[model samples]
Target chain A: MNQFIQELTKGLWKELPPFRLLLGLCPVLAVTKSASNGIGMGMAVLFVLTLSNMLISLVRNIIPSKVRIACFITISATLVVAVELLMQAYAYPLYLQLGIFVPLIVVNCIILGRAEAFAAKNPVHLAIADGLGMGLGFTMSLTFLGSIREILGAGTWFGYPVMWDGFQPFTIMVEAPGAFLCLGLTLAAMNYGTRRQLMKRNREGSEASASPCGGCRACSIGKSQD
Target chain B: MSVFEVFISAIFVNNIVLAQNLGNCPYLGCSKEKGVALGMGTSVIFVTVMATLCTWLVQKYILIPTGLEYLQTLVFILIIASLVQFVEMFLKKAIPPLYASLGIFLPLITTNCCVLGVTLLVQREQYDLMDALIYAFATGAGFLLALLLMAGVRERLETCRVPKAMAGTPIALIMAGIMSLSFMAFKGMV
Candidate 1:
């Protein structure tokens, strides 16, 4: 239980997918024109990520090391297809809004990255926790970014007008460039916060500050190779 | 649309990276060094065009005929994965020097949403074979163009003083945002 909570909370803030780990960025930049769209995309990803992680963890021992990646891709692709059908039937409008990004979720690095790094080694319950945590983190980040863009870009949040009548929307906030700029600035702010925290910890002469990459299993794997 | 117009629109008006927002992983990951960026761009061009051609045929002959259109995502991804593997093996044996330069990036291409995105886009737009091929090529070229420009800027960024918090990916992303804004100017050209 303790381990599960640890795994769960880590994804929430310590190893947040888009903002911190920087995985699965394509959809992050593309589908975030409004807060609702962000929630929609987040829900789809949450479904796939949680289920795929559970499935992969259950079969970890059966999968050959050499063929694991192909297996992972196949599993996620199937889930994404299920998501497409479900969205088409129930959420047709959002299906159209998200468009190619729905299918593109199959290639999202966060899903694949977690499958390879966390699920393949952990038990099913822990894997579920990790997936749930990561999925929620991803959804929160997307919604936050989307809300900022939508409120500023369209003078609305979740499609409701929030700004004064004469407020001029920064139309660029909803465009491709604004997505990049907003995300860039958000990441920088996060970094600033982390830096200040580290400095405060050091001034107290506490135990050495944890490495930013300490919680990032993916980067650790890459570093081990080098 | 005319072939010329499709080609121009793909490269400028609807650039795969700048306009469509696909393949950003490679756009940011590989653009730090000019040489790596060039290699990655070339390999993307080679794989995207080939994958488009093969997937187009598969969609026409197999998926459409069998009424398995619902399986489009699964089948396209499988085909692309296998296609990239074959291309990597063929390049390694037939063209050693080219393989040496592009070797590392080939496997990464399997997961690149750009290749799959282009194949799906052409089908969505109902482009004929010739138009599909040209569009795929032009899209790849646009990606290359964006990456090269970004690489040049990053190389220069190395010497400048950057804030501690915005030193690496943050600053690079802001730069990409600015570049994307400039690319928006081309919207009127086509």
Candidate 2:
């Protein structure tokens, strides 16, 4: 039980997909023009991830090592197709808004990375947990981006107006430029937080040590190894 | 309608990179180095042209004729993945040096949204085979051009002493914004 919690928690912050690792940004920037689009894309990804992970986990040991990547792609692609068909049938409007991204989900490094790293080695239940955790992390990032861009770019959230008419919406926020701005600022904020934490740790360490001179010895050893 | 318009629009007015915003994975990831960027650009041109032709046929004959158009995405992706594999293998045997430079990029192109996006747009626009091929090659060339320019700027950005917050991807994003705005100048060409 503890192990499952550890696996799930890692994806939320320690190994967040877009912000931290920067594995998948194509869809992150393209479809996040609105909050609804972001949530819709997130759900599609979640469904694909969970289904693909479970299947791959169930058949992990039987697959030969040489053809593992091919097998995984086929399985994942099949699930993506299934999801695409379901979306087309039930939610045509959202499906059309998503456009090519639904199919592009097959190439998303997040799903493929999770499959190669976790599902191919672990059991089905754990794979499901990993998928849910990672998918939610990705979804949360998209939703956050969507909210910011929608509020700033269109003066709306989920297609409803928020800002008064007098306020000028930054048109660039609705275009490709806005995508970059949102992504860059969000990543910089995260990096700044990490750097502050590192500084705090360094300060605490220095207070405990009698001399800062001795720390250079360890630093030099580490540098030499590099 | 004219070939010139197809070429011009694909290159500037409706650039795959700056306007449509496809092929961004390589645009941002591989644009740091000029030589590698050129190689990736050439590979995109090659694969995109071939894949567009192949997809045009499948869409016309197989998907539309038989009412399997809904399977377009799945079938198109499969065909593209296999075609990329075949091309990589053939090139490895035929031209070893060219293959080595472009081999790593071949696999990446299989999943590039620009390649698939062009193919789908060709179908969506109902272009003939010749036009599709031309548009695909032109768009790929545009992607290459954008990457090379970005590579040149990024090399120079290394020395510019940007800012604490907007150093890496942030600065790149801002640069992309500027590029998009510049490209907007050519919008009326269509």
Best by DockQ: 1
Give the clashing residue pairs of candidate 2, or none: none
Encode model 1's per-residue lDDT on B93-182: one tens digit a residue.
999999999999998988888998999998999999999999999999999999999999999999999887887788888999999999
lDDT minimum window of 10 residues, candidate 2 chain A? A217-226
- Docking quality tier of model 1: medium
Cα deviation of B89 in candidate 1 (Å)? 0.9
Candidate 1 per-residue lDDT, tens place, A95-207, comes to 99999999999988888989989999999999999999999999999999999999999999988899999999999999999999999899888888877888778789998
Question: Every model's DockQ, to 2 decimals?
Answer: 0.57, 0.34
Q: Per-residue lDDT for A191 in model 2?
A: 57
Residue B152 CA error for candidate 2 (Å)?
A: 0.6
- Which candidate number maximizes TM-score? 1
State the displacement of the C-alpha of residue B103, model 1, in Å, after optimal TM-score superposition: 0.7
Error of 1 at B63 (Å): 0.7
Task: Score candidate 2 by lDDT.
Answer: 0.81
Q: Give the TM-score of candidate 1.
A: 0.96
